[model samples]
Target: MTDQAHSLSLPRWKEPSILPGFGVGVGLTLTYLGLIVVLPLAALAIRPWELGLSGVWHELAAPRVTAALKLSFGLSALAALLNAPLGLLIAWTLVRYQFPGRRILDALVDLPFALPTAVAGIALSAIYAPNGPLGSIAAKVGIKTAYSPLGIFIALVFIGLPFVVRSLQPVMQDLDAEVEEAAQTLGATTLQRVIRVVLPALAPALISGVSLAFARAVGEYGSVVFIAGNLPMKTEIAPLLIVIKLEQYDYAGAAAVGLAMVAISFTALVAINAVQTWFAGRGRA
Candidate 1:
C-alpha cells in the first residue's frame, strides 16, 4: 500500500464496545461532567454580567459585603491552618498505630462529612451557647465561642477537619515504615527523621488537604449560620450575606458576592497548588 493510503486507513480512535468501550466511556463522562460541573459554572460566571461592571464593583465593595467576605476568607484560612497539624497527627496515629478502639476512632473521623451541616451547626451552637459546658469554660476566660467570629472559626474547624484527615490518610497508608526504620538505623534522631524523611514526603499531600479544607470552609453555610449570630458586619459570613441578599431579592448583589468569593477561592487554590508543586520538587531534590 502507498504510504498515503496507509496513513489514510490508519485508525483514528477506539471503536465503540458493547460493555464499556472507550467511545461510550468518554461520551458518558463528558455528558456527566457537562451537566454536573460545566453548565452550572457557566451559569454562575454569566450571572454577574447582568450587573454592569460598576454595579458589581459597588456591590462587592459595600461595607457589609466587604466585612462578610473578609470574615469568611480569614476564618477559613485560619481554620485550615489549624487543621493541618491536628489532621496530620490524627492521620498519623490512625495509620501508624493500632490501639484500643482504633477502628472506632477512625470511623469517627468521618463524622463531620456524614453529619448534616445544619445539624452540626445546631449542635455546635448548643455546645457553645455560654451556658453549655465548653461555652461556660470559655466564658470564664471572657471569650465568647458562639454568636461571634470565634464561633465561626470553631465551626469551620469542625467541618474542615475531615477534609484534611481524609486527604492524608490514604497517602500516609501508602508510605513505607521501612524508610523510617532505615533512617533510625542510620542514627537519625526522631526530630531529624521526621523533618528530613517524613515531612517532605507528606508536604504535598498536607498542602492539598489544607487547600481542600480551606475551600470547603469558605463556602460552608448551614453549620456556620447558627453559630455566627448573623450580625451584619460582625459575625456574618459571605455565604450568609449571599443568602440574605437572595432573600431580599437582590440577585445581582448576591451574584457579585458569589463571583468575588469564586475569584478569591481560585486565587488561594492556585497559590496552594504552587506550594504543593514546591513541596513535590523539594521531595525530588
Candidate 2:
C-alpha cells in the first residue's frame, strides 16, 4: 500500500505511450542540441563582450554598420511581404489547377533551394547589369537594377520565394475545394470567399512561410554580396559587413555586429510568432 501510494503521488512526466525509450530519445535530443546549437550560440554571445559593452556599442554604432543593418533587415522584411501574396498565388495555382507544364513549374519553384548562392548571385548580376537585357531596359527608365538596394531586394526575393511556396503547398493541398464551392453556393463573391474563408484557413501557414523567408534573407551572404556591389552605407548588407570586419581582423567587431543581428532577428521573429499565435487563437474562437 505504501509503494502504491508513493507511485500514485509521483508526477507523470509524459503520457503513456506504446513506444518505449522516451528517456533515451530525449537524452539524445538534448545532447545533440547542446553540442550543435547551444555551443555555437554561446561562443557567439561571449566573443562580442570581450570588447566590453562600450566597445561593442561603438562597433555597432558605426555609420557603415548601421546602414548595412538597416538595409539588410529592411529589404528582407519587404521581400518577405512581397513573396507572401506572390507565393500564395503560385501555390494556389499549383494545387488548385491542372495545366500544361504545371509539374515543371512546380519543380522549378525549388530551384533556389538547390542552387548555390554564389551562382545565383552571379546569374542575377548578369541579368541585371547595366548593359544586360533587363538592366538596359531599367536603365533606359533611369533606374538601377544591379549593384544597388534594388538588386539586394531582388536577390532576397529570389531566395525567399521557394520558402513561401513550399510551406504553403502542403497546406494548400489539404484545403478542400468543396468549402469554396459551399461558400459560392451561399452567393458569396469570389473575392469574398477568398478573403473570408480561404485566408483564415491559410493565415498560419502563410505567416510561417513569411517568417522563414525573412530569416533566410536576413542571413543571406553569398547571393547578396555579388549584386550588392559591397558599397559602404548604400547597398551593403550586415552579413557582408561582418565579413569585411573579419577580413580586416576585427574579430570582436565582427562578433558585435553578428550579435546585434541575432538580437534583432530574434525580436522580429518573436513578434511574428506572437501574431501567428493570435491568429490561431482567433481561428479557434
Candidate 3:
C-alpha cells in the first residue's frame, strides 16, 4: 500500500484552494467590462427601440446617411488594402535590411499610436492643403488632396499603418530565411520565391492586420473631420452623421446609425475571423 501510494502521481504544492480568489477576480473583470463596454453598447442599441419601424427606416435610408456610410466604409476599405502592401514592404525592409536611419524609421511607424488623432489631422491638413508643397504641385495638375475622399483615405492610411507593420513584424522575425535560400538554390526566381515561400507564413498576420486597420479606420472620427470637409452626401462619414443627428436632438436617429455601423463592422470582423480560421485549418492540414 505504501509503495502504491508513493508510485501514484501527486498534485503539485497545493497550499489552499484558489477558487475564492479566482472567482473574485473573474467577477471584478466581468463587472468592469459590463460597465465600460457592454453598458455603452447596450445604451446605443436600446435607444433605437424608441423609434418606430418607419422612423428608423427613414433615418437609416436618408440619402445623406447612405452617402456617409458608403464614404466611410469604402474609404476605410481602400486605406486598409493600400496599407497592406505598403506595410509589408516596410516590415520586410525593417526586418531584412540594415540601412542608415532604419531604426528611426521603425520607431516612426508607431508614432500614430502615440500622437493624438487631432494633431495628426491638423498636420496632414497643413501638408496637403492647396498652398502646401505637395498640394501646390498637385494643384497645378488640378488635383486636390485635402477636403475630399482622398484626404479621408490618407488620414485612415496614416492611422492604420502601425497596425499592419506591428502585426507583421514578429511574424517576419520568426520566419526562417533558410526556406527562401533553399528556394533560391532550387532556381526559383525572385518573385517566385517571395510568392511561394515568403508570403504563406506572413499571410495570416497580414490578414489580421488588414482587418484591424479596416475596423479602426471605419470608426475613425477626429483625423478625418478636418480633412474630409464634412459635406453632406459628399465627404461626410458615419460617425460625423451620428454626431450631427445627436446635435439635432435626434438621439434615436443617432443611435440607429451607430447600431447599423456596429452591425456592419461586426459582420465584417466575423467574416475576417472566419477567413483566418480557414487559413489556420489549411496550415494544420
Best by lDDT: 2
Question: Residue 218 of model 2: what lDDT?
Answer: 100
Instruction: Give the per-residue lDDT of model 3 (tens digit) for 187-258.
Output: 999999988888877888999999999999999999989888888998999999988988999899999999
**Local accuracy by lDDT, each model:** 0.92, 0.94, 0.91
Model 1: lDDT to the true structure: 0.92
Which ranges in model 2 have alpha carbons more than 4 Å from their true place?
A: 1-12
The residue ranges of model 1 lying beyond 4 angstroms of the native Cα positions read: 1-20
Name every residue pair that clashes in candidate 2: none
Better-scoring candidate (lDDT), 1 or 3: 1
- Write the candidate numbers in order of decreasing lDDT: 2, 1, 3
Number of the top-ranking candidate, with TM-score as the measure: 2
Q: Write the per-residue lDDT of candidate 1 for residues 159-211, one digit (tens) a residue.
A: 99989999899889998989999999999999999999998899999999999
Give the winner by TM-score: 2 or 3: 2
Q: After the best TM-score superposition of candidate 1, give how far the Cα of residue 48 lies from its true spot, in angstroms.
A: 1.7
Worst 10 residues of 1 by lDDT: 12-21
